[model samples]
Target: MTGTIHNRETFLSQIASSLGRSRLSSGVTDPEWKHRPQDQVLQDATPDELVDILKTQCLKIHTSLVITDAKKLPETLHEVVANYGGGPIVTWKDERFSKWGLEPLMKKEWPSQKLEVYEWDHTKGAENIRQAEKANVGITISEMTLAESGTVVLFSDKDKGRTVSFLPATYIALVPKSTIVPRITQAARKLRELHHSGKQVASCVNFITGPSNSADIELNLVVGVHGPVKATYIVIDDL
Candidate 1:
């Protein structure tokens, strides 16, 4: 234990000495020394520009992006489901979805036998993933989106579990265009502020960029090993 402590102290001392030497050699002080971050361009980007960048990045990351007006979202979503051969769908229970008139549309469009819509239940715990895994598709509303990395951030809980994005064969995400930021820093800051404010933030905050892919075994490409093989991002402009 003593030796480990001494080694750790030596490592820290070496780091401090190197930093001091570098600072002394560079005669100028960086603005970061005062703890101020660089100017955030993403936060200043217009919503429309951010959305455009997000769409482009999504394609590069192998994630499909569907843009539809708020009024046409239901039909658009239905089309996507039909293309996937409408089956079981696991979705996060967001109150906004019902208000957007999706619930009625779903009930009318999807018959009980033809389509099963499962709302993630908090009481199920780890079993939530099991339910989602059985579904053909999973859907969730993204709280924030990073255009830089083509990532959609989901805050999950009993009402909305990360399983909706991680377990299904196809993951569909509703990303409000307004939520699209230029990068991840702003998304992280928003999350931190929410947590600092004592809001009921989710235990699992997920950043999903695209469909799961790995070139692991003998360099053979594999998809959907860890998560959904297909990820669809629906950018709802009106929202």
Candidate 2:
């Protein structure tokens, strides 16, 4: 981000000089932006209200939202898997899945299980991408969520690869209620604190609002052009 600012300064300086305007210098710091009505609404929302607002915003962008108990996550995941039918499942290595007791649903089941799922190996580099490309579902746990825009924030790591949230037909985000901030600013503040505290922040932090869609071709809306055809956000009430 700092590098981006430096590049922007150079580019803007050239444009400003051409227009005979004052250059946006590197020393210039923009004033902090005030909150908009949408932002303020989220900032003052209760937990339930935040979820409702997030769900509404998510639906507007063609993302499905589901609320479920932490303990019932296995059942919810089963339904998601059933909806997608049996296929290769690629998931990020989040400890929350284990804490939520979704092992039975994620891993190979016993002899009498209803459905069998192929768990993609959590590897690195091209191998992981190769596995995820053929996967039907990409499951990940959000580090935090933005209620104002219904965005799920994912950080890439050794356990959670970047492609784990992309390159799949279906993307499912498992977010805990506690991790859902009232707005994006709050989320950014938390991450900034973590960074300043000397905690190891991941190299990539992806803020996903919805499935990849575009209407640039001919004005007709298109879905899943560069991302999942279906995106689902499963919010856990208790985590």
RMSD in order of candidates:
6.6, 4.5
lDDT of 2 by residue, 1-239 (tens): 35434577678778999999896535867687685564565566788988888889897889999999977788887787668764577877666777888777566662234543444455545778887888888888888998878899998878788887789888999988888887777877888999999998888889998898899999988988998988999999963
What tens digits encode model 1's per-residue C-alpha lDDT throughout 1-239? Answer: 23334576567668878888522333566464554353455667778878888888887777889998778887788888777767688887788787666985346454333577778778878777788889888889989988888999888776887778888888888888888877877887888899899986787888888889888899987777788888889898874
Cα shift from native, residue 191, model 1 (Å): 1.4
Model 2 spans with C-alpha error above 4 angstroms = 1-41, 110-124
Judged by whole-model lDDT over C-alpha atoms, candidate 2 comes out at: 0.80
Among residues 3 or more apart in sequence or in different chains, the pairs in candidate 1 whose N, CA or C atoms overlap within 3 Å are: none
TM-score of each: 0.78, 0.80
- lDDT of every model, 2 decimals: 0.80, 0.80
Q: Supply candidate 2's per-residue lDDT for 2.
A: 54
Best by the TM-score measure: 2
